[model samples]
Target chain A: MALLEARAELDVIVWPEDRACERSWLMENVVGATGVIVMFPEKVNTELLDKAGPSLKVVSTVSVGYEHIDLKAAAQHNLKVGYTPDVLTDAVADLSVMLALMAGRNGGIGVDLVQKGQWPNFSWSPFALCGPQLSTTAASQTRKIGFLGFGRIAQATLARLVPFGITHCLYSSNPSSPPNYARDAALAKQHNLRAVSKVDIDELARESDVLFVLAPGGSGTYHVVNEAVLKKMKRTSILVNASRGTLVDSDALAKALREGWIWGAGLDVVEGEPNVTIDHPLVKEPRCVILPHIGSATLETRGEMTTRAAQNVIAAILGEEMPSQVDLSTVL
Target chain B: MALLEARAELDVIVWPEDRACERSWLMENVVGATGVIVMFPEKVNTELLDKAGPSLKVVSTVSVGYEHIDLKAAAQHNLKVGYTPDVLTDAVADLSVMLALMAGRNGGIGVDLVQKGQWPNFSWSPFALCGPQLSTTAASQTRKIGFLGFGRIAQATLARLVPFGITHCLYSSNPSSPPNYARDAALAKQHNLRAVSKVDIDELARESDVLFVLAPGGSGTYHVVNEAVLKKMKRTSILVNASRGTLVDSDALAKALREGWIWGAGLDVVEGEPNVTIDHPLVKEPRCVILPHIGSATLETRGEMTTRAAQNVIAAILGEEMPSQVDLSTVL
Candidate 1:
């Protein structure tokens, strides 16, 4: 509600327009709205049947996830549903790379050294404060890149990692419509990547020098990278999680990083986030890089997302084809 | 001696194979040395004469400053004296730009916020933790870049800063030199910079939004940017010192930064380093960025310096031109 008020261009009355205001408040606020916008938070159930009045037209969301909105409600309303997607892929991927670089070189540890004034008196050796350089060396030979869910952002991230000397790629994903093997094969052909899917997660852990998690976060993918899978990872392997926090078991991860099961973890999300505390166990490790969920916060990308979201609502209300609409049947 | 023992190359031999044992242990260790590298502590007068003997051929110091070496000694011995000169200009200039950027935006302070886990819990506002960006907008647009001693490195630093929307540059040099107006003109022509040598140091302080102390350090240049100059500088202006620590009074600088005489200071050198403690007054300021004496420490640059020093010794022994000989006339 606050976001809409701030972005008043959105003028659409829906079941959720004045969810708590009053009986006709939705109609009052969006008197002639041609489009309706929503997110995972708003429940668009049967209650929408009574409130969606004739003025209601289209639906859009600020989120990529559309789990809460009722597609049935949207269909009954005969309204197009719009959602912002793909806009965040590059920005999120850039953050993942930043996290990986910071973690691998112990840059996160330098934070303490900078502020504490210990730099001058600190006894340093060529080997001291030295961490692995991302460039493939004679010893490491080749950096094998892998992804748990190779979606839009994951592919972009892989492209960026290539210049840093990646040798092979492996990935896994849930089977999509008519089977997505053809699509996966086409993409691999395009990027010259080896596209292997839905392999035993253990293979991903063992063969990968860097693993990126790009799958949607939910119950089905909960704790996908658990103790057994983590144990299978190479001791020098790095795990980069930018998608969501729930897919990883934080306690198990802390233990693994502590006991040297893997080289490091770079995370932009943590379960029950925005509440990440200093005492968070992962923060204690020299190899973990925890960003405050700024994956899609680049100036250009965020600005574009905002403008696109606004335009989607405006266009849908004007009774035009939505720029983008969620196809949730694929997910269900 | 310590450096020579660490590096035993087929460069130069300053003593007889039989007299190698009689030579000063320090000189003896730097055997097969092509260039007799000397820094501040190793006096290159008669002491070097007795030590270097006939094997002592080319004298190369690893620093831009070579006042400690004796020119007459080299001339008398028919020895070439080499010093590292222009190799680090770009690297040092790059660091100056980084320091300016970091100080202007208060990047170093964020290290504490992110590492201490104080983010996300409290939402930072539009103006919160915000310092002025390098490029100012229409409402408030004013920025002036200045230098204390505009030499080669200063010129390089100025070139790097031009992209940041700088409109003017004011610098001072040794009053004794017949005003380096030609170089200033060349810089102006190349960078389209409004380069000028101000007669009064206070004039530069009043006009500049950032002051770079690129002057040499010693009795001749000591306390050049003193309280008087700092007082005249804009309150929002910053000071960066990569040249020498003695150019600015450390205590006065600490006070200036603390009391807001100027925005901040970025220092890579201190008056008494290694001996300087965590409790040093300058280190107490959160705005100050004090790097160890690593201006020429980049792997690429250091390797070049070491290799060049070896070449100097090798060439001098072979009666070839020393690649970079120090103008000892300046030291006297």
Candidate 2:
């Protein structure tokens, strides 16, 4: 609204305030629209693009993931695409570390016990409600953190973990991208870590005290943390997924948690989220802490993302370069 | 058991293992006991000292807080008091930071919404489920952290917050203790914080984005964060109490939450904990994230504490300097 109000020269129409814009309404209203800003709920497919006609100069998404956008079709139609990235890295990374702490400390169980009025009956034993400590203690000297995708958010999470006395890091990035030993070495030195090395998915699963799934969501990365990988993880290890839910197999994770293959899981996103109910497999597990896809839901971050998305649309419409234009070639 | 088994010369009698030893059982078993190891539930008062006759040389508690013990009675009885401190610092500190993050990010509300199966109906908007971000963002350039007590756990908690881009710190230590400006300067420089200074309680409440109550629990500090202080706090701020329950007034805090005096609160310890029921005012608040007094509840920390308590008892019985002995003069 701020962006639209700032541009007095342009006329704007908003989807009549609802949780999400109706498809039929959007299709009809977008007929001769010059620019469109959408959230994750709106599917920016070829159909929507076709209805918008050639006048649509830009499609800006207020999210880092562009999976909902038909990038190839947009490119063919000569429409520039922009996504809100980099801005949400800190917010998402904060949630990632919070989830790690929550999962490792039996956060869900503790809260449930309290909320259910069971605490009075819950006697305090020496190790009652005890879970793995997030910070490294003298008894447990070494701590290793693993990242499924060592991207911007993962690296930010690593920086936060340094003070927790984490000694080592292992991450799996795009297998095709050549490993940067120089950058890894410098990061290790900078953070005073024993090692920060790239490794195979199996090694990452087996070795990490806490495994973080921060990879992109796509067919290539789907179900990367499946039953086999979960089986390889330590019984005391924790799994945290702040990335897209599809990157982890929900059923497999539930089984692993039930069988004590992994200690706990903290998920901000589930395979089918917003649709997740109390009867969901993961939700039934006592140790599993699940939040409803709120990884980048912070006032500060959301404000920035909205501004960025608006800026992209305004820029593209004015025949100027989009501030965060997506590379169509990579999407294709 | 390990300690008793290791020492063949000492005669040890074990309590009939229950959640907590019954007072009758403890009284009978303590008769002529040379040393005793107790948890928080077992009070080490003058009556217990009398029941033990003159044989009691030590009363070692496997806990950091010794408020359950009658310190003056122990001092007069010529009994050495030992407590498990420092060992659980990391665990408690970890929880302190976790609580802060949880409070700031609306963790409790989100979990409840999902657990209660309301998430499916909960539609996502640009600002839906948005709470204050724990990490400082470009728009919000500064974050100020406050500490009610600048003790070991508080310092450790501060260390964890350094990476979150907290710019300034305000701590109100024991007013009787002379201010250490030099140490504050060094700490500020070490963490690259803009400032680290001791301030009055009012200033601490007014300035802090998140105020941590880590002070000792006693008459002097009881209800330190009462209605007036709560009123002075920022509406966007958070209050986290990982210390003893007595330091915070539960009703006042609940009112604060109800009336939106502050954004939210994360409490590990309530005024009447272990007994905090569903009807409890704070528990009834949507934003209040209450844990079951599990601040130091970690396997590693508990194990270390148990070992340390045993060692203290063994050492005291042998007429050697007990490790981590409590200064009885301070108690008096």
Model 1 scores a C-alpha lDDT of 0.65
Q: Candidate 2 residues B225-301, lDDT tens each?
A: 99999999999899999999999999999999999999899999998777889999988998899998888899899
| Residue pairs of candidate 2 with colliding backbone atoms | none
Native contact share for candidate 2: 0.81
TM for candidate 2 is 0.98
| Every model: iRMSD | 8.9, 1.3
TM-score per model for chain B alone? Answer: 0.83, 0.97
Q: Against the unseen true structure, what C-alpha lDDT does each candidate score?
A: 0.65, 0.91
Listed in order, each prediction's TM-score against the native is 0.56, 0.98
Against the true two-chain complex, what DockQ does each candidate achieve? 0.10, 0.79
lDDT of 1 by residue, A74-107 (tens): 7766766777687767656655665665455443
Error of 2 at A25 (Å): 2.8
Winning model by DockQ: 2
Model 2 lDDT on a 0 to 1 scale: 0.91
